[model samples]
Target: MALDKSIGVGMIFIASFVFLYYSIWVFILPFINESSFIQQFFLPRDYAIKLPLLLLLLSGLFVGIFVGKVLIKNQQKQKSKKKSQ
Candidate 1:
């Protein structure tokens, strides 16, 4: 239904926004308390930025996929109903 599609879009939007904010925090927050060398090249520093960015990107991607799937399913069902009618 249209309502379902709208809800899906809204949820995806909100989720993507939250992920973006989280990514910013995760990516940048560590620079506040650590040494420059450790912050730049160490395992923790590297993972801090990379992991959060990857998660953020993947979350957005999956949300988009979920929205697309929902829309497609709704359209197919409606098309089938129309055909039957």
Candidate 2:
């Protein structure tokens, strides 16, 4: 599917949430007491680090798509104006 501003923003929004969740789980939670209720949600040892990086990738993808759309739009506008001349 073509990437538009609206869709790109939505993806970034979701990625933000995932990144936040990952941050709280990875950084803050480690300092908390082991017996704390939040420990119950601790991710598996293998996948814990991977999930946050994956979300980071998603956010980057959204930003790239947004930039790509703007660049394409500007190029097309320039081409159209040249054609009209």
Candidate 3:
């Protein structure tokens, strides 16, 4: 196979989970973890910013990898089709 099926699926799955986690931790939880009213209302805080950014980056990487694998598979398919023709 031009792309490893299990790896491609796994990468996408992992990326999706990372994206979910980032959304919850970075975007959602700060409102809930209110130290004070002002902190909650005005301060847009990225709690654990670096780690989430890293996770976001990793998620992007895995997505890109999955897309590249798909493209490789499509290209191989076209090549096989041309040879058969």
Best by the TM-score measure: 2
lDDT against the true structure, each candidate: 0.77, 0.85, 0.75
Off by over 4 Å in 3: 1-47
Query: Candidates 1 and 2: which is better by lDDT?
Result: 2
- Regions of model 2 farther than 4 Å from truth: 1-24, 27-38
Q: Rank the candidates by lDDT, best first.
A: 2, 1, 3
lDDT digits (tens) for residues 1-85 of candidate 3? 4479988998999999977765765667666747655444333454466666887999999999999999999999999999999
Model 1, 44-84: lDDT tens digits are 54665688789899999999999999999999999999999
In the predicted model 2, the residue pairs found to clash are: none
Superposing all C-alpha atoms, what RMSD in Å does each candidate have to the true structure?
9.1, 7.5, 9.6
lDDT of 2 by residue, 1-85 (tens): 5679889999999999988987887778878888888878767555786876897999999999999999999999999999999
Error of 2 at 3 (Å): 27
Q: Estimate each model's TM-score.
A: 0.50, 0.53, 0.47
Error of 1 at 2 (Å): 35
Give the better candidate number (2 or 3) by TM-score: 2
Q: Candidate 2: worst 10 consecutive residues by lDDT?
A: 43-52
Decoy 2 TM-score against native = 0.53
TM-score of 1: 0.50
